[model samples]
Target chain A: MNQFIQELTKGLWKELPPFRLLLGLCPVLAVTKSASNGIGMGMAVLFVLTLSNMLISLVRNIIPSKVRIACFITISATLVVAVELLMQAYAYPLYLQLGIFVPLIVVNCIILGRAEAFAAKNPVHLAIADGLGMGLGFTMSLTFLGSIREILGAGTWFGYPVMWDGFQPFTIMVEAPGAFLCLGLTLAAMNYGTRRQLMKRNREGSEASASPCGGCRACSIGKSQD
Target chain B: MSVFEVFISAIFVNNIVLAQNLGNCPYLGCSKEKGVALGMGTSVIFVTVMATLCTWLVQKYILIPTGLEYLQTLVFILIIASLVQFVEMFLKKAIPPLYASLGIFLPLITTNCCVLGVTLLVQREQYDLMDALIYAFATGAGFLLALLLMAGVRERLETCRVPKAMAGTPIALIMAGIMSLSFMAFKGMV
Candidate 1:
């Protein structure tokens, strides 16, 4: 249970897919024109990631090591097709909105990375937890970035107008260039926050233990002590 | 659209990397060095055109006739994966220097969305065989153009002072954004 929670929470912030791990960037940049679009893409990814992780974990023992990647791609590709069909049936509009990205999910790297790194080695339950965590983390990041772009770019939040009538929308915010700029600034801000927190931790650790490592999180030396 | 128009629009207006946002992993990953970018771009051109042709034939003969169109995602990806492996082996045996230049990047193309994306796009657009090939070649060239431009810029960026936090991917993304903005100038040209 403890390990499951650790796996789950790590994806939320510590290893958030787009911001931290920097995986699956194509969807992150392309589909984030609006908050709803982001959530939609995220949900599709969540569905594929969770089920693929579970299936891969269940069959981990049977798959040959040399052929594991091909196996993983096959599994995820099947799931992506299912996702495409399901979306077409229930959410036809969003299915069209997402377009080719739905199929492109098979190559998202986050799904393949998790399958190779976690699901292949871990048990089913833990793999499920990791997938759920990473999926939710990816969803949260996409929604957050999407909301920022939508609000600034179109003066709306999730299809509803939020800004005053006088507001002049920065149309570029929801365009191709805006996606890159917004993500770049967001990553920088996150890094700055992390650096500040690490510095504070280092100061406290120095006063308490006179440690030689200075409690820097970037290195593994201080991690074991913590 | 005319084949000539398709070629022009693909290379400029709807560039795979800057405009369409496909194959970003390699666009960023391989663009740090000019030579690697050149190698990656060339390999992508070769693989994408071949993959598109294969997928198009399979779609026309196999999936559509068998009514297994819903399985398009699964089948196309499998074909791409196997095709990439075959290409790698063929290159290693027939053209050692070309294989050496491509190196590991050849295998990585199996997963690059641009190849698959182009294949799927041509199908979605319902292009005939001739148009499909031209479109694929043009999209690949667009991707190559974007990658080379980015590599040139990033090479210069290496000598510049960047803040610690935004030193790597963040700054690279910003540069890409600027390049993308410039590419937008070609929007009306098509």
Candidate 2:
């Protein structure tokens, strides 16, 4: 239970796909102009990631080492096709809006990265948890970033008008340029926050020690290791 | 669309990397150095042309005839992955210098969405084999053009004193965004 929680929550912040680890960046910048589209893409990814992870984990032992990557891609591609068919059938408009990205999900490095990095080595349960966690993390980031872009660009939150009548929307936010700038700025802010937290922790630890314990090389090396 | 228009449009207006948001992973990762960027770009051009041509033939003859269009994703991706592998080995055997330059980026191209995207687009747009091949070549050339431009910018960016947080992917993406905005001007310039 505890390990499962660890596997899940790790993806939420510590290993957030887009912002932290910089995985699956295409959809992050391309399809995230609107919150609805972001959420929709996220859901599609969530479905694919969870199932692929589970299936890959189950067959990890039998797969040949040389051909495993190809095998993993084949599995995910099949699932992506299924997702594409389902979306086309039920959510025709959204599916059309998504365009080639639906098929492109088969090549999303995040999914393949997880299958190789986590699922292949772990038990099925942990792999599924990791998948759910990473998927949720990716989806949450997409939705949040999308909402911000949507609100600022279109003056709407999930297509509802949120700004004052006279307020001018930052039209760039909803375009390709806006997606890049927003993600860049957001990543910078997160990095700054993490650095500040790490610095605070170091300072607190240093304050508790009165004696000078390290010289130039050792102190620099210690911080570098941290 | 005429072949000339397709070539020009893909090169400038519908750039796979800058506009379509395809091949971004390798676009960002391999655009650091000019030589590497060129090598990656050339390999992409080769793979794009070959993959689209092969997939088009497969879709038209095998999948469509057999009523297996639903398996396009699985089939195309498998074909692409293997195509990349075959290209890698053939390149290594035939051109050692080129192989050395491409190095790891060769394998990375296997997962590049631009190649698959072009192949799928060829099918979706219903381009005949010759047109599909030309379109793929155009898209590949467009990718090369964007990558070279980006590599030049990044090379220049390295000298400037950037902020701690925005030094890497953040700034590269912003630069690409500006480039994308600029590329919009070339739209409909047949």
C-alpha TM-score for every candidate: 0.95, 0.93
Interface RMSD of 1: 6.5
Instruction: Candidate 1: list runs displaced more than 4 Å.
Output: A204-226
Q: What is the C-alpha DockQ of each candidate?
A: 0.46, 0.46
lDDT tens string, model 1, A1-226? 9999999999998888877777888899999999999999999999899999999999999998998888999999999998999999999999998999999999998999899889999999999999999999999999999999999999999999999979999998888989888988887787777666666777777544333322222222111110
lDDT of 1 at A215: 20
- Clashing pairs for model 2 are none
lDDT of the candidates, in the order given? 0.88, 0.85
Clashes of 1: 0
Worst 10 residues of 2 chain B by lDDT: B163-172
Query: For candidate 1, lDDT tens digit of each residue in B1-190?
Result: 8888999999999998888888877777778788888888899999999999999999999999999999998999999999999999999999999888986787788888998999999989999999999999999999989999999998999899988777767788899999999998999996
Superposed by TM-score, candidate 2 places the C-alpha of residue A68 at a distance from the truth, in angstroms, of 0.3
